[model samples]
Target: MLKAMSGKMCSSSSILQAQKLVDQLQIEACMERFKISLTAADLVRYCQGHRRSDPLITGISSSSNPFKDKKTCVLL
Candidate 1:
């Protein structure tokens, strides 16, 4: 249900799209949490810099040739 709402707002799993939604919600939540209104750009910049606290989010790092001549373990 929530996923549908989120996807309708923008592309699925897009950083910019998700950031836009977060910024919109943050304005209301931030005011209640901090007693002030913060702009979307400011919020986006802050969140990008401190991603450790991000909830229910995962980031991927990939490389075509990540390792050379490395024998990785395999599970039977």
Candidate 2:
């Protein structure tokens, strides 16, 4: 294959190198897109997990009632 650049002849090796660079750029772009998709999925999963585990009853612990554990003290 023959290619002209600025009225200059390009060698086959140079064309091959250019093709390699193009392929590498495409691969990088695909990887970046994949990473973004994975991150979005992870965020959704986290949101669902948090929402699912959220208790409907707020602060129902037995320790919340101070009078429940009251002790009578005898003074000398």
Candidate 3:
């Protein structure tokens, strides 16, 4: 799906046409899902790093993640 869209985006003659292709592809939703998942992973890493020296907080961040294969999430 993205590969086809990429070709269309590249072949687009004008900025407006490219923008229209992006809109038709719903790229914003894909981008937002990617952002949320990446942010969640980063947050987990940060908390684990900070908690290492501060024993007051204890938790584990798993290297194995179920969402690794997930491509999209529900948009809020």
What candidate 3 gets wrong by more than 4 Å, as runs, is 1-34, 55-76
* Model 3: how far residue 3 lies from native, Å: 53
> What TM-score against the true fold does each predicted structure earn?
0.23, 0.37, 0.27
The local distance difference test score of model 2 is 0.77
Candidate 2 residue-wise lDDT, 1-76, digit = tens: 7779779999889989989999999998887345878899999898777775554434445666655756678899
Q: lDDT winner between 2 and 3, please give it.
A: 2
lDDT of 1 by residue, 1-76 (tens): 1245644643456656778999998897867454235666788889888787554354433443354445778899
- Top model number, lDDT: 2
lDDT string for model 3 (2-45, tens) is: 23454564443566686898897886667545578889999999
Each candidate's lDDT (Cα)? 0.63, 0.77, 0.64
- Per TM-score, what order, best first? 2, 3, 1
**Candidate achieving the largest TM-score:** 2
Better candidate number, 1 or 2, judged by lDDT: 2
